[model samples]
Structures are given as structure tokens and as C-alpha cells.
Target: MNERDVPGWKNCDTMSGTTAGTTAVGTSGTQALDTREPGAGFGEMTRRWRDLTGESVPLPAFSAGTRAGLRGRFQATRLSDTLVVDFAADSAFRTAGTPVAGEDVVRLWIVRRGQWALGNSRTDNETTVSAGGFMLRHVGRLTHFATPPRTVAQVFVLPRTLMRERTVTGPAGTAELRLLVAHARMVRRTLSGLGPAGVEAARGTLLELARAVAGRRFDDQEPLLASPLAQAAKDLAAARLSDPDLSAAGLARELRVSLRTLQRAFSAQGESVTGHLREQRLEAARAALLTAAPGWSIADVAAHWQFADASHFSRAFRARYALTPTEYLRQQRELRAR
Candidate 1:
């Protein structure tokens, strides 16, 4: 399919052909397809996705009409000889195919956003995964999937030989799955900066976590070793610091960890969840103060960063940086002038 047939992607480049082979060798690292670029379209995205991951999407479900801003990001990271992590989001598509010979891999598709309808052509049975749910299948056989628009998902591709069972699926409520997702995120986020040894270590940690999720093995301490839940919390908090309701309990709930577990994770790193969150907010506010528009006020910056009020913001800012917001702003301006 070409760009003309796909709305919202009219500016993207067009190309043709289907059928991709997942012939990654000698540490292929990562392959990516981002349709958000200028002059980029699903035609090229599909071809690239097919070529990299050996999955084919000949027809995306846009016939009935789709949202105009149809953009997407896909990445397949080969973490080890036995493990590959595939992530895709903000796209509507369908994938149906039997593997080429020797394509012996098991795939676990975890849905983070919209629903996924997965079917087995042979059995004619289907499984639907809602947000926070997961479906696992052995890709050595026929499997099909339909993803809804604006879907966010991740697929953990493992060699079939690694799994003791043929299928591994789980509900949205599983703590194990949540922890696995956390670990996967940690590994993916840190992979680029890691040395060869660090990457291998992360790969092994994630693979073990995946095995535990598949019910192959388990150790109570395995999850903790696999993920820096505190770091993940910090990353998430930094992004959502503007929300006044964001707190340790909310963060723990979102991360699928107990309040105690969240506290322990932070304590292990010599910090408290609320304290770290506050520090991050203050830092963000400080940066904003430096570049804020002339009309922006101290109270505006304080409110934007979720401080209770300008007075509370000033007290906290003074305690942390030894200067009130007003003083810090003036000091920065004076420094710039000098």
C-alpha cells in the first residue's frame, strides 16, 4: 500500500513490497521505524518494519476512516542471542502470517493502550487484550493480530526453546507482568549508554524476568534485581510533575507496586519518593524561571510545578537552593547581564 491510500500520512514517502525476514545476526542491536518524520509515511514504515522484524502488515485498517494525525513509532531491540523486544505505538494495523522455516520464536504481546484482538487461524479462536493485559504465542505456528488506533504495546520475542509452555498469557491485574514491564523499560532506557558487559547483564536480567512471567521460574528477589524501580519512578515523576495529584501512592499504584515496596525501592537508593519528586519539581521550576516569558510570574511557575502556593513554593525553593524564587530569578538575570 502507498501513502495516497492512507489519510493523515499523505506527506510520507511511498514504497511497495511485503514479506520481511527476521535474520538478525551478530548483534543487530536496534531497528526503528518512525512515521512521525516529515515526508515520511506508512509505506516506508511498513517496508522497514517488515524487513527488520519479519512481520508483515499488507493492509492497515483505515478503510472505514481513521484519525487524520496517524503517526507511529516502532523499535525492535535485540538484547541478547535469545531475546528481542519490539515496541510499537500510536498506529492502527493488522499482522497475520506464518513464520518462514526456522523462525522458531515465542512472542509475548503486552497491551499498554488500546485493545488487541489476537486469533489463531487453525483453531479459529481469538483472545482480546485490553489495556494492561498481555497475550503470548509461539510464533513457530500461525498467529494473527489486529491493533486499534492509538494503541501502545510491546512484544517480547524469545526463542521458543526458552519457554517450557506453548503459550503464556496474563490479565491486567498481574503484579508479575507489571514488574516485568518495569524491568523491560529500564533495560530499554539504559541500553544505549551501557557497555558491552552492562548490556549483557541487562539482557540476562530481563530474560530471567521474562521467564518468571512465563512461569518458567521464580525467585522472590528476582524482580528487584532486574529493575531499578526507583529510577523508573523518578523518570515517570519527572514527566508528570506538573500534576498536583501526583504523589507516592499514585506513583506506586501506577507502577503496580505496594506503597511499602515503592518506599523500599527509594530507600535503597538513599532517597524518599516524595523528596525526590519535590527536588525534581524544584529543579524543573528553576529552569523555567530562567527562561520563562516576561508575563510569567513566580506564582505561575510555582503553580505550574504543583507547589501548593507561592509562599510554600518560596519556602521549599529557599530550603533547597538557599534563595527564594524571586531572588533566584533576579540572580540569574544579574548573572546573565554581567
Candidate 2:
């Protein structure tokens, strides 16, 4: 309860009424107690979490089964520059609390064992996470989660500054409410790979996973460029661009729109759906070539961008950039050297 009582975990002088816990066993930093109960004593926790992560949201009840009797523990620790938190409960409970807005908390959770469901009021996104899957919480709006029976999860609470410094974009703001279901077996394997000495490695791997999920959502907004049907069709096409067999019929089937409707959607943009796909593919290919290493072969770069053949890739590259892939790479190197 008090700072002097808990050894290794001290009190942050700058943060009043908060306890700091540090471990010499691993990376060194501070751990602070912000809130214990789901609704009670959460002000400090909300303030500190928001300060570090820039996410604001209302803390919902731990569960709905108990009618708000069970209280969740809120503990935060700073490992080097990264922050970690743990929220646990052995019983089922729920609550209808006010929303916490404008705060972002990028959370990496390992549901050690048990089932949990997290719902976001703002995004209307509900995620049911099982024992093996990992959950990343992006805190910005009203969010809620509950577990059945004995549930334990280790949450890595990351600061916005640390994420930005690492060039890692996680589900922050409204984006955090989205649920990412990673491969359960792969997640278990990754966790197994993290022994006592592999904490840093584990942290990096988890961060990559979190960033990928968040980045995909961020990139997915391109489909909402126009409106109702047109944007939906465009989004579907973008999501399936890697599938070489993706066709206008397949896209129409996925979007549940008639071929005529799909055609009209693209016509509004003054281009056909097939034309858009070609343009996107060409743009992607150009980007891949531009970023390829100086010594990377033209064929390798072409393959990376999913070009059908080297000659076709060369023709498209020349048509678009007025230079072949080889010529472009050579010019880039010359510019860099100069």
C-alpha cells in the first residue's frame, strides 16, 4: 500500500500517490501502482497511462457476469523506456462507466489462459480472444473487456514517445479498439522462445506484430477515399492486390455488387477497375525498385513487386518512369554518389 513497504518498487516523487516498482533482475526502470479496482482509484492510472501513451478512454467494468462486483488490478512498470502493465481477474464482472477520450495506450496482451471479450463503444468492434491468441489494445475511446473463470494477461504498456522513436506505429487513438487475431500456434511458439535471457528479443518481436496489425488498419483507410459503394469496391481491390488471380468478377462477388455497379464505381473516378489495379501494381513495383539495395538484381526486385515476367516488368517500368529498372537503379546510384 505504501512505498517503504514494497521493496524494489519505489514511489515516483513527481507522481503523487503512485508507487514505483523496479527490478534489478531484468531491464531497470520503475513500476507504479495506479489503480486496483475497475472503477475505484483509476484517476492516477488514467492520467499516467495517458501521459505516457497519449490515449484517453473510459475504463469499463471488468465483466458483466458479476454485475460489477469483481475489481481488476492495475499495475504499471517502466522497463527501460517501455512500460508494462498487468490486468487480472479470477471472477466474472461488468460495468457501464463513462468514456475516457483522447488517450492512446498501445497494449500487448498475452491471455495466459482463459477466455476474454473486449468491446469498444466508439468503434463498435468486439473481439473475443482465446487462450493462445495475443490482443493489442489501442486506447483512445470507450473500451471494455471481460474474462471468464481464472484469466491472466501480461500487458506491455508502451509510451507514444518510445513507439515513435522506434518508428513503430501501433493501434493508437480509435485504431486501438480493433482486434488482431495472430496465428495462435506461432504466438505460442514465439512466447516459448522467450526465456529469461530473451526478454528483449521477445519484446522486439511482439512490437513488430503489433505494428504490423496497426499499420494494416492505417493503410486500409485508403478504401474510404470517396463514399459508400465506390470506396468499398476500391478497398476490396486493394486488400486483394497480392492475389494474382483476383479479377473484376471476383471483386464484384466479394463486394456483393453487380458487375455493372462495380464498373460504374470506377467510372466515377474516370478509370476502370482493371486500370486502377494496373496503376497500383505499377506504383508498387516502382516503390520496390526505388528502395532496393544498390547491388540488388533487377529480376529480384521485379519478383518482389509481383511482376509476371522480367520483360513485362521492364516494359512497364520504362513506360512509367521512362527508364528501365536497371537504368533507374544505375541513375539512383549515380545520384547518391554525387
Each model's total of backbone clashes? 1, 18
Native-referenced Cα lDDT, model 2: 0.50
Superposed by TM-score, candidate 1 places the C-alpha of residue 77 at a distance from the truth, in angstroms, of 1.6
TM-score of 1: 0.64
Tell me the tens digit of each residue's lDDT in model 2 across 94-193.
4343454554656556665676566664234366667755655554443665567557665565545323322222222222112122211222224323
**lDDT tens readout by residue for model 1, 1-338:** 23333333222222211112422221222333334455555566555544444442222323222223344554455554544445444557555333243456677878878887766542343777888878766656435566776777777777666564467776744655655666666655555456556656666766666676777334544445424566667666877989888999997887666788788878777889889988999999999988888899999999999998999999999999999988987888899899
RMSD in Å for candidate 2, one decimal?
17.3
Q: Ten-residue segment with the worst summed lDDT in candidate 1?
A: 11-20
Q: What's the true lDDT of residue 128 in model 1?
A: 79
TM-scores, all models, native as reference: 0.64, 0.39
